[model samples]
Every structure is written in structure tokens, then in C-alpha cells.
Target: MAILTIPVAYLIGAIPFGYLTALWARGVDIRTVGSGNIGATNVGRVLGFRFFVYVFLLDLAKGFLPTYLFPMAVARFTGHAVPQLGVFVALATIMGHNFPIYLKFKGGKGVATSLGALLALNWVASLAAFVGFVLALVVTRFVSFSSMLGGLVFLAVYFGRVDDPWNQEHLAMSVVTIGLFSLLVVRHRKNIVRIKQGTEPKVSFRKKHPSGRVAWVLIPILALVGAGAIYGLAAQANRRSELRLQPYDLTEVERVGTGHQRTERLAYADHGKLLAVTCPRYNRVVLYHVTKAEQLEVARDLELEGKPVAVWTTRDRLYVLVRPSGDERHVKPGWWRAFDLQGEPVGQPVPAGMYPDDLIVTADGRHALVLTSGRGEGDPKRPAPALEVFDLGATPPQVVGRLEFDQPGDDPARIKLSASGNYAAVTLLGSNQIAAVDLANRERPALISRSNLEQSEAPHLTESKDDSILTATTPDRDAVVIPWPKTVATRGGCIACILPQGAGLTLIDAATRRLLGEFPLRAGSLNLGVARPMGLAFSPERGLLAVATRSGSIHLIAVRDRPENIGKHEHVAASEHLGRRR
Candidate 1:
């Protein structure tokens, strides 16, 4: 019974006070537009005093009635100590109201809900917490800080008064309330910092919406209902699950300066022991012996050719695939030629008249895979629109195989390669499908998964580790690695990316195929490895994962610490075969 109480509390807490309030004000869903918080304050801020009152009252009703009055009803009907359970139920309601699961578990803080619970537990104590918040805000001018302290005060009120009318049997609840309140404070720790620094804005009752109702007549009533509704939901006994997450920091062990664009390309070889980076601005290849963390400018003399598109280095030679521009062809749809590290041409350019935007060289440096049409950033126009597999060692590429999808039906911008050359994952844009191919039989790659594409975006393969399909998700930009490590076989899978909106990264164990956890953005940087985080590179020598943003900052994050959403699954690849002949 006690075990069940926590889930119940979470359910009760999930109610959207601001949402209901918004509806009462405008007869519309608050989340559909504006800042989508469904609290009484937002209603007061957006809808003014008249409707703010309606919303606050409705919210208070949900907050207070569920936790207070409902428990009484149950207690009277059962003729038992139902109020004994009320404490647990009320706590659950507060959690549900703050962080609901049904609506992506996103909700406002629990002040109104807590007020409702306190009213149900003891009106005298509830009044004390309310006054404390108002007074603190008046003095410190920090609403968040006041809320934090007010919550503490509410928990504090139960302690000193054993003779108080409702103080006899609320120990379990007192502890739980304190714990939840602490979590809230921690989550709002940033706000606390702002408050301390005098940067936090005061809670203004001033109206900001032109269509909003009058402010003076609205706010108080909404607060009243917010209290009531929360208690009422508690009375109904709602349940919810809990989530725990830890934050991490991003460290850079090595970095190189370079200009960047959205369609940046990278190639790793020698089991990712060698990371080769090519930038249009640098117009050359930068090689790093990842393990030693040593970097070298192996070749910068490709002046006659286009910027480095894809690079691979064998033990004795280097092969680079370039899509030449400022010519008859556009940047992404231009000529793709191969050159040795000595700046010597290896083979005929892949296409006689067209350039390739993307490339993947074979493990032995014997072949080069090219993707055109899906070229040049995310323009969606001027798509080179074809696949060309070239023999890297050939004077001009020896066409090994090719595939082309109809326009609008397939926008193949994202691609991946397995170490065994057994599969290729393609993100078919303008649609939904994680295109899987059988690379084992080079002439014809078969589709293994097409219907279940969550989002086949920013795809990568653990080329060094052998067999994992790694893809970046849209919306959240999470790196997901699905492995078929048992043997070198092409496996079929569905399409998917980040999900449930606003949820953190979901880690899946390749072997068990179970979701490990929702990994948070552990790195301290405001953002990286996500949202058009166009570049990721793992340097085995440095034990670092390079995360790059379009704005031109590269972060070398340590992979060992298990950063929240940083590293990709298919860590590195071999490029001896993709380079010039020894």
C-alpha cells in the first residue's frame, strides 16, 4: 500500500492548472500558442484580472478539493482513517500537477498545488506558507526564491506544533513533501542563482496581453481555484511514476580552428584511430592520430580540386574524394575526384558530369560510395540525386554500384556504412523511412527496414567497433546506436528518432535491445551534439569525441564518463582501403 502511494501522488500532480486557466480565459488550449505553461500566473499575465480569476479559481479547485475534501468524503464513506491516506494522496496530487506524464510530463511548479494540500492538511499552516511567500517576494523580489522558501515553510509548519489540530499523524507526508520541495529547488537552482545575483525578475501582476481580461478582478480567484482543483484531484487518488537524472560536463582535450557550414563532412579510418576532418574554408584534410591526440596537416595542396568532401588514409597513402565547385556544377552537385596524399589524382572523377555531396570509403580503401542530389546543406533544391560507388585506387573511379530514388519521394541527405560493408542506412527525407541496404552484395543492396523510421537523421556507423547502426534524431538530436554484433550480417530495422517531445535522450542497449535510460545533456555547454550539431568525431588516441556546431566551436568530450547525449554508437571506421594505394 505504501509502495503504491508515490505513483498516486505523481498522478495527482500532473493536472495542468495553467492550461485549464487559459481555457477559462480564451476558450483555447494554452499550449497551442505563446509560452505554454498552464498555471494561474500565466493566466494572470496573459489573460488579465477578469479571466485570471476564473482560471485561478478553477486551478485552486483542482488543487485543494482533490487533496482535502475528497479524502474527507472517502473517509466518511469508509468510516475509517481515510485522512491517514490523505497525506500520501495529497503529495501525489502535487507532483502530478507539477510534472505530469500524460502531457510530456511538463507542468508548472507546485506552489498552488502545495497550497491546496496545506489547506486540506491544515488551513492555519496553509495560510502561514502563503503569507511567507508574499512577504519573501516583497522583500527579496524573487518569486522563485520565495516559492522555494515558502515550500520549506509549509513543511516547517508541521514540525513545531504537535498540538496543532492536524499534526498528529503526518510524518511520512512531511518527509515526502520536504523531498519533493527540495527537488523543485534543485531544478530551479538556476533561478536561485539569479535571485541571489539580483537578476531574477519580480512576479508582476501587470497585464501583458492585449486580449487579456482585467488584472485586478482575475488573479486571486484563479489562485483560489488552483488550490481547490489540486486537492480535489488528490481526493480522486491519481498515480504517477518518478524520474531521476544526473548532469555531466563536456571537456575538450584537443581542437583545431576552421570555418564551418551546415553540410560539414567527416571520415574516420583505422578503427577510428585516425580522424580526418575536411572543411571548405580550410579546403584541405586535417588528420589526427586519435590515440596519441596528435594532429597533422597531411595535405593542404588540393587547390586545383574542390574542398575536401571525404578523406581516407591508408598506412602508406591517402585517398580523398572531392566534389569540385565554381565549375559547371553547383557546390553539392559537382565533380567528385580522388587524389593521393601527394596531391596526385588516383582515378577518374566518380560521375562524368556531376559532383557527389556525400561519400563513404570501403574498409580496405578499395572503394568510395557517393550520394548526390541530397547535397549541399538542407537546401532541398539542386539535389544531385544519385549514388555512385567508386574504386578509390582507380585513376578515375571504377563504378562498383549505384542507386537512385525518385524525387520528393526520396531525399537521401543522411547516409551510414557498416564496417563489414554489409549495410547502408539512408534518411529518406520529404518522407519517413530508415532505408537499410545489404552492402555484402555490392551490386544490389536490399532494404531491411523502411516503414519504421522514427527519424533516420544524421546517421553514423561504429566503423571501428564493427557493426552498429548509429543515427541522430531530429527535434532533440540524440545519438542512437543499434548493433547487429553477433556476426557480419545485414539486419532490418524500423525508423525513429527522439520522441515524446522535450524528453531527454533514450539510451538503448545494443545487445538486449532495451532502452537503457533517458540520457540528459550532461555537458555544461548550452548546447552541442544536438539540434543541427552537424559534426561528431571520435578520436581513439585522444579518447575524445569531437562535437561541432555550425557557429564554429568544436568540443572534444570525454567518452568514458558517459555524457548524457554526446557520443554516437558506430564510433570509428577504417580508411586504409579508401585512400590512395601505397
Candidate 2:
């Protein structure tokens, strides 16, 4: 995923929206002129209100189009859900605007990008969050407070379920994005505190604090909050560990109940027998028994005790997490750990705090591939974040090899393995490169780059059952689905359609290592917003293609007439529309 993310972040941040606005008006890089940051706030500081609006919109576009628009295009073209992946892509895009690699990795503070993220998720709440920030700015005259308070208020609105459609997975994503965004702002709390002291730089357009009474009210609230926490913890013996998942596929799946908050990843057991999903909300791992159509909380939160980010299973064994933990033995950080299906300690979690990110396992579950580093997590001081390859069958889950490029840091947006687990699709951020690695070669993974450098977010590689073909989804444009064959030899086909950016299923030429062209995927309808295809699986026996999206929609596609029926390349041909598809 980092492979594709580097270019996405670079290109998205390189947009120079703020700098361009500042330069067009004042002929200076916004960063050099104000706080020396090429972000909207910096632009607003230097360019004033009228010009800053344009900068803000442009900066928001850097976040919006890339994070939301781009992913929609890819989903429409590839017929896959890239939204779950889009979260990371959006994060990368935000990181790009905040700290662009082209600008020596120091860009803005990510306010605009975060606002764009909110907008992509839900326009109402995002707008409310925007109003919250504006209100803070209007009252306090402190942009930092406004920014922090905006996110906090948005988090509250998010957690409060204001205007949210009741869906646990969707809500989980909300908390995930909000928590991460809050952390980003929290890292700058010192600056926010300084602003409260009336020592930080103030935006000229904002008003002064309304009254001292508000601050007085805050005092009691803080005291009460602390008191509430103490009482809550005292009363609570265990963090709400009970979780029940209701599976909702378009056809045949039933939901017994819903999941608790903080859930990250989910995958089915053999023959979809059980759902082995990762729940970051309650900080536990859970296994849902599907036979009885009831969820049995098998194992709850079992990482290094930090957060279980991603998990994938083979059969009775599950390769749980691809994140770092406190190395009690090594006293180091950044590691990967594995647990059995029963949540028992299988092998010690590998430490890799130097690289903080996500991971994905191959379909066969034989190889555990790790990807880390993005935004603030990518540290140039230590070892560059890498793709640590581990052989799951090894007694200790031995590190067989790793994947890195000539680039200074990893920019992978998403790591995708073909349905058969034969090929690896890695999308690089801000660039047109998509490294197609062959799992057969563990020592040296091959690389591929697309032409035309655009802001492509999540790169999804898909394949059919019993078929060696694959396809790549470029999140930049929705008009054309570029099909890259996983054959590793020649460039392949490009399918043309009015598919939403990164939000549809696509065709693949698995033999040629090139795209076999694309067509509109029908039937699945997302609630709304950006529709990036999330996860995909093909039934070898049934020839059915199942695609799930972050918008909480699962689609069923049959492949009996897929080749001749699809790839005809007609936007009107698709039975599904972008609005419904999301």
C-alpha cells in the first residue's frame, strides 16, 4: 500500500493550491511567506480572506478530489471497494498536503485535508464540523483552537451519531478517521495551548473571544469529565468486550446483530464458516460463528495491546496483526505479531515501530506482507519503513525477505493480492507507478509503473478464480479503467466508461501482466458518498464475484457471460449508477 501512497501523497500535496494562491496574489510560496507552511491556514494567514478562500478550496480539492473523487473513480472502473483502502489513501493525501515529499516532506498542518476527509465521509457532519471550527475561530480568534475544536466537535458529532445512518462498520470508520485526525491535532496540543495563552499567531479575519464565562464553564466541564472517567472506570470491570456481527450480503447473508465500535478488519473462515474480524473499537479480536448465523465473541483484542489494525485468516490458523507493539524483550517498538485462531500466542509479534502502518495477507494465507510508514509516522532518522515479508508457516513466522524501492521512503497506498494469491498489486502515491510483485519470487519482487503521473490513491489488483488474469484500478480518473495484466511481461488494456473514480469492478488479463480493459459492475448499491471497492472474492465453483464497499454495500456479480457481457465499455451499460454504487 505504501508503494502506491508515496506518489499519491506527493502529487496531492504538490498541487500547490495554497502556494499557488499565495503566489498569484503575493508572488511567494505560502510556506516561506507565513508560518512557512504551504497549507490553507498558511495561505489564509498571508493571502487574507478573499484570496484564502480560493486557496482553501484549492487545498480542499487536493484532499477532496484525491481522497473522495479519485477513489470513486477507481471503484467505478474496477468494480471493487477501495474505500476501506481509501481511508489510508485519504490519510496519505492529507499527509501529502500537510507534509509533501516534494517540499522536503514539510507542507501544511492538514486542516484543509481533514475537512475534505470529513466532507467525503458525510457532507452534513463534515459541514457541522466546519461550522464548529468557524465558530471557534469567530469566538476565540485562534485558528489552532478552531482547528482542534473543530475536529473534537466533529468527533463528538461523529460519536454522538448526529445525522448518522445506523451502521456499525460505517460508524467504526468514522471513529477511526476521527481518532487518527484527533491524534494528528493532539500532536500539536502544545501549540494549541500556546494559542490559548494569546501567544500564537492569530488569523486577522476571526473575531476575539466572546467572554471569560465560557472559559469558566469549561473549568467545571473538565473537572466533571475527569470525575466521570474515574467513576466510569471504577464501575466498569471490563471494557465492553461483548460484540456481535450481523453479516449483510445482498443475497443469503443474515444479521443476528451488529458489532461494537472500533472494528478495523474482517474476513470469513473456510467456506465462510466464521468471520475472523479485527475490532479496534474495543481493542480485541473476535470470531463470529456463521453456521448458526450468530456471533460468538471468540477472541477479543489480542495485539501487543495497542491496536489490532488488520487481520487475515487461512483456516484454523489466523495471521492477526501487521502493526508495532512495545517490545518488552527487545525494548524496541514497531513490530508485527501473530496469534492462532483461538487467540493463543502462535509466534512472538515482530517489532517494527520504526514503521507504523497497515498490512494484508495473500489469499492463500501462506505469506504475510507488511506495509508501514506515512505522514508523521515515516521517520527519516531511523530505518526506512519497509514491506516485511514473513512466511506464515514458519515455526516463528520467520522473516523471509522484504520489499523496498530506490525512493527514500515508502509511499504505498494499498497492497492488493490477486484472488489466487499469485500476484501482488502495490499502488504508489503521487506517482503513476504500480509495482506488480510475483509471490513466486520472494527474494526480489518485480515492479511496474503506470504512465501519466496523477493522484491515484488505492490501487486494487483483482483476479478471477481458476484464472491467472488480473486487473489494476487507478483511482485518479473514472472515465477509463486501465487494466494491467499480472503476467509480468507486457502492458495491457484500458477500459473506457463513465465509472465513478475508483468505485467499480474491472477485468484483468492475468496472463499478460496487463489490464484486459474494464466494464461497469452492476447490482451493488452503496448508501452514498465516495464508493471505493473495499474487498473482493471470487467463487471458483459458482463463478460469482462478490464486491464490498466502505459505503456498507455488498454486490454479487456472476462471471458466466462476464467477458463478452462486460468490457463493452459503456457508461450507460452499467445497471448501477455512481450515486447508488457508493
Q: Provide the lDDT at 342 for model 1.
A: 45
For residue 314, model 1's alpha carbon misses the true position, in angstroms, by 5.1
Native-to-model Cα distance after best TM-score fit, residue 77 in candidate 2, in Å = 36
For residues 411-508, what per-residue lDDT tens digits would candidate 1 score against the true structure? 55556676566777766656655566777766665566564455422323333355665643322243433322222223422111244442333333
Candidate 2: regions farther than 4 A off:
1-249, 255-259, 292-304, 324-332, 356-366, 374-377, 419-422, 448-582
- For model 2 the local lDDT of residue 134 reads 89
| TM of each candidate vs. truth | 0.41, 0.42
lDDT of 2 by residue, 358-440 (tens): 56676666777876543323445555445667777878677787766446334654566654665676655544455666666
Could you list the CA RMSD of all candidates, in the order they appear? Answer: 21.2, 17.4
Candidate 2 has its poorest 10 consecutive residues by lDDT at 241-250
